[model samples]
Target: MSNELYTVIPDGSVTTPRGFRAGGLHCGLKKTGRNDLGAVVSDVPAAAAGVYTTNVFQAAPLHVTRESIGKEGKLQVMIVNSGNANACTGEQGMEDARSMRDAAARAFGVAPHLVGVTSTGVIGELLPMDKVLSGIERLPAAVSGTREGSEEFCQAILTTDLVKKEACVSLTVDGIEVHIAGAAKGSGMIHPNMATMLGFITTDAAIDAEALQSLLREATEVSFNMITVDGDTSTNDMVVAMANGLAGNEPLHPGHADWPRFAQAFVYICRELAKSIARDGEGATKLIEVQVEGAVSDEAARVIAKTVIGSSLVKSAAFGADANWGRIIAAIGRAGQPVNPDTVDIRIGEIVTLQQSRPVPFDEEQATEYLKGDTVEIHIHLHQGDGRATAWGCDLTYEYVRINAAYRT
Candidate 1:
């Protein structure tokens, strides 16, 4: 893609540049007549890195891509479809995912293993091969670097997303300019262990497969891994990245002098993408940042923070802006970690809700007023150790229930 932002541009065609071409087309898998199939093809071989769901009931695409990533870190194309998650379909499901890749490989004239596939939406049905294959056949013709094509690509991968999600960042490394652009789809089922959402990031920077994989994993840990929507991981979760070395910079290596600068940019892009997913969470009207400090360990802090964020009671309370400090304390107590309740403290925004083990006197009206904003912060101090961690989540609301209730219909 070009250094210019494409898909999300307000008044332009969704065209990308020469190094990348994307397309989204109607495949009939979705009843809404929205584009349900998309493809992203790199003009040349690119270093690829991916992280898949940790769920045991993995999707066919997850299994296939896992093997491919193990064998070769370079990829040329990705094929994705929405409205029919090829999961729990037995042996035939595996074939369907492979067929999707094989068809894309044929269209792009690349090896089947070099093509990555991802699917989302309704989990138990066989993929409609007629529609999927027909869509794959049209990929060559649909290939375009235009802004309109990029929008189509974003729309095709969406399932229940109310708004299309995208982020872009540019950086200069070694006097060379590089651009990173990404698109993601997630409104529900978004507790990512590896990557609970479907997101793709493309960059023209030159980096080897091994370095790309390392950088991607590091970035994902602090970005996608720290967010939750409903605490439910998906079977088809994936985050794929491609670096086509089109930026004309020197290959990046971990120990190299320029590695730090490149790594920073990589993490910045991943963080932006992760935040976009949280902001666009299904039926979410607010975003919450849960920050934990002074835990037994960084890992322990993360567990505690995620536990608090995942609590239905906590989420509902946050949605209601009830200033329920007891629920927050209760969540921390049940986090399965060694901690002294007497040493625990909690705060909302800048208002201390609980200090040490007792409630702190504060104006309920003031706290409620703070919660009315689109962004809220919850802080916890364990006073037990120096470790700290932060996680992102959204409040629970009736709209969330309504969206998922009729999702498949």
Candidate 2:
């Protein structure tokens, strides 16, 4: 959609922004021979901000990445590998993550501190440095500042994700078209802990490091932090963002006249990517959207919405196309959020199954037809206040258990 504010561009990724180049290749880390290694580099150092998983046992690469961002708030390249999480290998894992950073710096001709590294899959295993370093060396040659290169990078980062997740939008900044885009990879072990998964976003707008960080944090609170998959947080969740001054726009700040426009576009990209991750969750057959409104407060609404979406019973009901509204009501009550028990309303799709906290007659055939779609909506109105929030998740299916049961296989 194009308008005076922002326009959505299809098939966009990190490389859609000016000065960024990216690609990936199979590096033997994955037995399937699919691409498992990828890198993204900016022609010049970019303003950087990163949000990491809140799991107590953090992954090794997260430390190096956090240090890189904290030290200079700038990044030129990011080295990423799938198939090995580089977590719980103790000191050696930290060392390997650092070595990956250095190897990538050498490959991209950037300082070590300017590189950020991340990994996923098979935690508790050390990275195969020989293969990873070799991939790094090949990464520079494979990476191009083209859309195809962006798609390659996208494919390289996936683990159990069934489909690629990418979003892009362009807006006029200082009369110049500035692009903001993002891609993410997540399926299992996903729950909102600051950021629920691994995501990379790039923009061509000239924004201060502090301003960009502020926007990222604010946007993530309502976007990535509102999604859930399996209700388990990962040890390596991170969302890193880079902004290069290639768009030739004046420096942007909190009070900048066009800051809201840029912020909205950035958040839209993040939200779309979040929804895609939820839709593509392991063994997920349908995306579920939970909307909670008329709560006592926005925070209360958020907690209720997330609880409803994260409920296994609710997810199972959605998967089976069952109009069992009791599970949702139970989730809301146990969410610890203040709610008027006598004034609650719940609906599945267009069928209002609960009115005034009581059961309402609904057609089972219509509910089954609605839930059969690829996406489902569960709406709740507390009739308490104007507070509102929305969270996303996927229906729990038998295939989910099967996938995880043999995950290591």
Candidate 3:
């Protein structure tokens, strides 16, 4: 009923929420027999919302998914596959995306318009519908509203992701217990102005479709949109969420009394998942958090934070524990935001390396020691206003280059 509503279940996943079931299986999409096809279905019609990549050239599956969501605000299923992006394959690709949804709907006992489909991995490849449909036919039996079911689906959706990613939290609305959960995948091509990231969230809190869309956009601004793996955003970026009203809670809207608590928990899960994706950036060794504060406005702070975290120089320096403060300051200067040259300050962890735009006489050994840790925090203050923002990335290394160079080979 209040902001202090729910607790986090350590072993929770997308299926932790009520009314949801998920499963995945191998269908020869990947070179090996790893599960590459997956689906998540709700027991009832659920309100749905999606945010997608802003790239000029869109993917076929994205178009199909959009049509499904546009037909009705409610959805019951999402079919996803890894190893074949099905992007830019022309008209056949669009039909294949739609066909996958229809096949999945029939297999799951739902309407085709109530199903959405997404694909990831190699672009410009046509989806092998025969194998994908075969996988869908068997999904109903494998899918269940259990942790194992969610875990299997998680693996099926991954491409370069090193490990499964999921987050869940519990909350109460109108005295009714509600659960929210999410899962995502991205290891490279992840500069989320949306990312190559594909995120799916399921919840049992009855929320209005319009309200859900607004909430997702606002939360993404500070979560998914604040993460960077590399400078490139992928062709298949998307995050969709479904809310089934099985929790018996009062409907949530912008004006709902418990909307704040629900939104807080929702954003927390998104941020955790975002951080996880950043930490797992291809061949990354350490997580990097860039915090920008005291800017002229929140938007300015966000730009500065993102620019700093997305800097290759800064990332490489962190990888080597170089303690190169000049790279950090140079990044700030080139962020294209108005900053008082004499009012800037910077720090790595707790070690102050720059003060008021001047080099702070500091111990190189201390700075190197701080950067040697598994997580690095870069803090900057402009001393101009109260605005603040945080962005996440990872330490760039030689392994990153090696992995990406041979990514397709």
For model 1, name the residue pairs that clash.
Answer: 13-147, 13-148, 14-146, 14-147, 14-148, 15-145, 15-146, 15-147, 16-145
RMSD of 2: 1.0
Compute the lDDT for candidate 3. Answer: 0.90
Each model's TM-score, in the order given? Answer: 0.93, 0.98, 0.98
Q: Sort the predicted structures by lDDT, highest score first.
A: 2, 3, 1
Estimate the TM-score for candidate 3: 0.98
Per-residue lDDT tens digits of candidate 1, residues 1-409?
Answer: 3332222322322123238878889979988799999988888878899987888999998888766666678887888899999999999999999898888889889988789999998898999998899999997787677767778899998887878776665666567776667778887898858544788888888888888888888888878888889988988899998888888888878876677866776676677667777767788889888999999898899899888987889889888988998888889999998789788889999999888888889999999999888988999999999889888888999999999898777
Better of 1 and 3 by lDDT: 3
Candidate with more favorable, higher TM-score: 1 or 3: 3
- Residue 145 in model 1: lDDT: 76
Q: How far is candidate 1 from the true structure (C-alpha RMSD, Å)?
A: 3.3
Q: lDDT for each of the candidates?
A: 0.82, 0.91, 0.90
Looking at candidate 1, the ten consecutive residues that score lowest on lDDT are 5-14
Lowest summed-lDDT stretch of 10 residues in model 2?
188-197
